[model samples]
Target: MLHRCNEQLQQFSHVNKKALDQYVNFTEQREELQKRQAELDAGDEKIKELISVLDQRKDESIERTFKGVARHFREVFSELVQGGHGHLVMMKKKDGEPADDDDEDGPREADMEGRVEKYIGVSFTGQGETQSMKQLSGGQKTVVALTLIFAIQRCDPAPFYLFDEIDAALDPQYRTAVGNMIRRLADTSNTQFITTTFRPELVKVADQIYGVTHKNRVSRVNVVSRDDALDFIEHDQSYNAE
Candidate 1:
């Protein structure tokens, strides 16, 4: 009986020791998990802060670019059309987003703030009259559009530009101004201009001239002298008039 009692006590002592070791190990693991969770929480906050700073920089860059483009547009317009004024206006969306069936009461203020889409409205003043883009004459509209393009180019110039009949709708004076502008740009910058124009204003300023002739529905492009190109354009104009 004494031996059996000694065996029972030993078994109980072993079980209790095993349980105590397990409890200590579980406590250590819990503490480690808590430490990892804290680190993760801190990292998450840092990431959020970085994201916020990036968003702010994005907005600032957009605002600066828009202003630069607008200023260039005005200057280019004035250059193209003497005694004229032009400006660009930024228009916010009224409803924040496009219409959807799921949105019954339109977008909320927070939704509107999140939207980045915007419209540019052009205001042009020429010949003592201010007009919206929709109200301008076709020729006037063409000038305004080209002015805007030139303005953007001033902000961010490309290596080259290809314009087809850019002055086709312009008056003779406007065409002369535009041609001079192109000439000055070419002389001052590394950018190249490849334009197809029927007017002599542009042809006279050409560094090289090419004549395209269509015969029997086959077109041929060949390098020609500046004089030859001008003569061809004049002949074509006369033919069209006839």
Candidate 2:
């Protein structure tokens, strides 16, 4: 009985040692988990900060681009319409309506910062008219559209441009201005303009010209000289007059 009791006591001691080791291992794991949690929290905070800064920079870039394009639009419109004025408007909205900051439920500060960029819009006023684009005549709309295109191109120029019947709806005065502007751009900038027009204004300023002839079901395109292009324009004008 004495030997049996000693063996039982030894077994109990071994069990107690194992339990102690397990407790230590659990404690270490808890500490490691807590450290990792802290690191993850810090990383999350850093990511949020970076995102905030990126948003700010993006807003600033947008504001700058809008302002620049607006200024260019104003100048181009004046030139195209001859005494016309134009500008861009920032339409900040709250729930799809115009924002009013005085309201208690107005947009937050962050929303305001981004709203200008997100809701930037254009307001066009044609020659001797104090109306919006929707109220402008078809000819006026064409001129305004062209002005806007040129304004945007000034902000971000391309290597080449293709315009199809851009002067079709334009008045003679506006067409002349557009042709002059295209010539000026071609002379000053290292860009090419490919335009199709039945008016003599564009043909007169063109470096190269092409003529398209369609007979029955067959169509043919051929390069033509400046005088030939002008003759074609004259013939088209006469046909339209009849």
Candidate 3:
């Protein structure tokens, strides 16, 4: 009888232990579901906030784009009216930055004045050497003209460069220097150049040459090969011999 009672008590204890384990597991699963639902709600709120912020940003961006385009068109219109005679206009900075000044008009005026002075190498003071485009000699004026042209070209480079009698006023040495400079610029930028000249020395460095002349009141242009040019020079020398 005692052994039977002990076996029954052990079986009862085992069933109670299994039921307690099932209760604990059910409680844990319910807690985990609640935690997941709370997390999902938080995520939804965060996504809504982000969407609101993005909408605001999109509106701001569209406004900024339209303003930028309008400003660009205004600048283009101004340039067209000015006959494209000015240097490349860049934004002005006060104290080396855009925002260091309280006055709005100060920076623009300063930048325009600075650019004009720099382009002409002028001084605010009366003591400095004054050089004007009209007062310069032909060669000096050519140099100044070329300098201005180069400055403008640096701002906006073109596909082809045509130099018509640019070296007409230059001496032989200056002509060679200008030729070398052009060659260097062409080499670096891969720009095609067509220059008209009557000087053989200037034509010597050209890759291709076209001679333009008026014959019988008609203009004729002939593309002369390097060999033909040499032959022509030799034939002219022979004629000088006679």
Candidate 4:
């Protein structure tokens, strides 16, 4: 009877072991399914974010293209009119109304007009400045010209800037201000600038200097070494004093 009881106990122990193994397998399958569902959810969220980014980029591209075209038009008109006034206008539909006015039906014209109005600003200088252009001392006119040119440049920055005699008429203080402003613009826009001037003070700030003079009716250009250029200027001043 003791031997029989021992055999039954062994059988019961084997059955419990098999049942525990099945329970562990079911638990593993449930955890794997949960993990896979989380991965799917994460992938869906990433796709949604990518779509949103792409849509934002598309809208930005469209807006920039419109602004660029408007800028080109303004430049052309200003050039043609010799810096005279020009206007850019845009039309938009009233809120809660159809996109078209009495003149047209489609959305294209309204959209175009809206973009034009949205991006362009009317720019003008005082008549006093223009009228005094000639009578104003060279220094004053230089300031005015630089102000206008800088204002236009600030409106739409580019990769390069060319300035010829911009500070020739400025005083020492104004010249320093102009230089500082140039450096600021360079820092902000990654712009490279080349300016030509007869002023020694201005040339001191230049990265490179080219000296041009007419000799015997022929134009001669020399890349001036900084020290040599300074010595030459001193020699010329001494001779003038003598």
Candidate 5:
């Protein structure tokens, strides 16, 4: 019996060494994994803060651009009009946004994406009222639309511009203002403007003028004197009748 017990004890000693080695290796690996996880957790907050700051900077950029355009629009509108002003109205999401497809709350950290939009609006005290596009008169709407285009271009100008009878709806005074505005813009920038108009005011501002007439059922472009251009505008009925 003593000999058998000694043999069993030797076998148990070898088995215990192998098991202990495996346990030690597992403990080391687990500790390393935990340390790595802690490191990642520490960096996570910084990454989220960076994202938030970048998002805020993006919003500020948009806001600055919007304000610039709006200011230019108001100035142009006033130049093209006698009274009232315009705005580039910004609309925002007033309610909390749903975070998930099921309408669950989204991650608070990722919520900085744009939840706002901007729209153009105007008011005409000359009309004795103030309202959106739906309530504005034809001339009012035309002036507003034109001023908006001019504002956007002023902020980010194109190489050139093409306008088709943009002053048709305005009165003589306003038409002349628009024509002067075009001339000033042309002088300020290298951008050229090709505009079509029946107003003598606009023709007077033009470097060259063309008279389009259907003679013998064919369209022809006639280079005319400033006086002749006035004749065509004032005598539209006779000009077209002939």
Candidate 6:
């Protein structure tokens, strides 16, 4: 009789707990859903505000850099091209980078569009009418690229710079211009410039030459005097001619 009574009470307890389980779980589930909705609002004003401030600073920086670069570019390009003149114009290419997401700029296209997308357009007379990089001859493009590089370095100079055959496209004239430039900068400027090149012209202007040679598998660096390097190059060229 006692066993039957205990079994009946256990069954009664199971049904009562099942009935309360839904109400107990519903309270926590609703709170979590509410929290998730708040997080997923898709409107992050603080992030947007931070982005706007950064964009404004970027525009100002680019504007100042463009002015400095354009002025220097005109002078150097002229020198490099042997009486050539060019212009550097900053214009919009496309929004440099889009908003954090499409939704971030929703309904604010006009404001955000103007904030991004500034690029420099290079045009030179006598380089044909195309005024495009692709249409430019190798030497012409090298002059433009090297001029801009020097211009930027002038604007914001650091201790040293590295170059790897930056004037490989140039002919003798432009190469000499580049050599003269290297000489001038090395003699006048406090900053050191390091470059690797096969051009004898460049080696002549270089203050130091670290000749890298790979033997078997290991590379060795030979520090050669400028006078010796020039003599070696002349001898090699003469031998090649013979």
RMSD of 5: 9.0
- Considering summed lDDT, which 10 consecutive residues are worst modelled in model 5? 98-107
Best by TM-score: 2
After superposing candidate 3, which stretches have Cα over 4 Å from the reference?
1-128, 227-242
Model 1 has a clash total of 0
User: Which of candidates 2 and 4 is the stronger one according to lDDT?
Assistant: 2
Tens digit per residue, CA lDDT, model 5, 1-242 = 99999988988774565777899999999999999999998899889878778776666665566567767876888888767655555444543321121211222232456432322222333343436677767887888788888998899999889899888788778888888999999899888899898778888888888888887889999888889988878898477769
For candidate 3, write residues 95-150 as lDDT tens digits: 33222212222122222223221222221111133334566579756654564455
lDDT of 4 by residue, 11-45 (tens): 77745657778899999999999999999999999
Candidate 1 runs further than 4 Å off: 1-41, 93-132, 216-218
- lDDT, candidates in the order shown: 0.77, 0.77, 0.56, 0.58, 0.72, 0.71
Model 2: weakest 10-residue lDDT segment is 98-107
- Per model, state how many residue pairs clash: 0, 0, 0, 0, 1, 0
The TM-score between candidate 1 and the true structure equals 0.69
- At residue 75, candidate 3 shows an lDDT of 37
List TM-score per model, in order: 0.69, 0.74, 0.43, 0.41, 0.62, 0.64
- Report the lDDT tens digits of candidate 1 across residue range 45-137: 999877766655554565567667777877898898788776665444563332222212222223213324443333455555556678878
For candidate 4, the 10 contiguous residues with the lowest summed lDDT are 97-106
Off by over 4 Å in 6: 1-53, 93-113, 118-130, 235-242
Q: Write the per-residue lDDT of candidate 2 for residues 1-242, one digit (tens) a residue.
A: 99999988987774565787899999999999999999999999999888777776666666567667767887888888676676554344434432321212222335424534465454544444446677877887888788878988898999999999999988899999999999998888888999989999999889888999899989999999999988878987999899
Candidate 5 clashing pairs, residues 3+ apart or interchain: 99-106
Tens-digit lDDT track of model 6 for 109-210: 233544645443444434323276777788778787888888887778778878888877889888888889878887778878787776688987776777
lDDT, residue 109, model 1: 27
What lDDT is obtained when candidate 4 is compared to the true structure?
0.58
CA deviation > 4 Å runs, candidate 5: 1-58, 95-113, 116-130, 215-218, 237-242
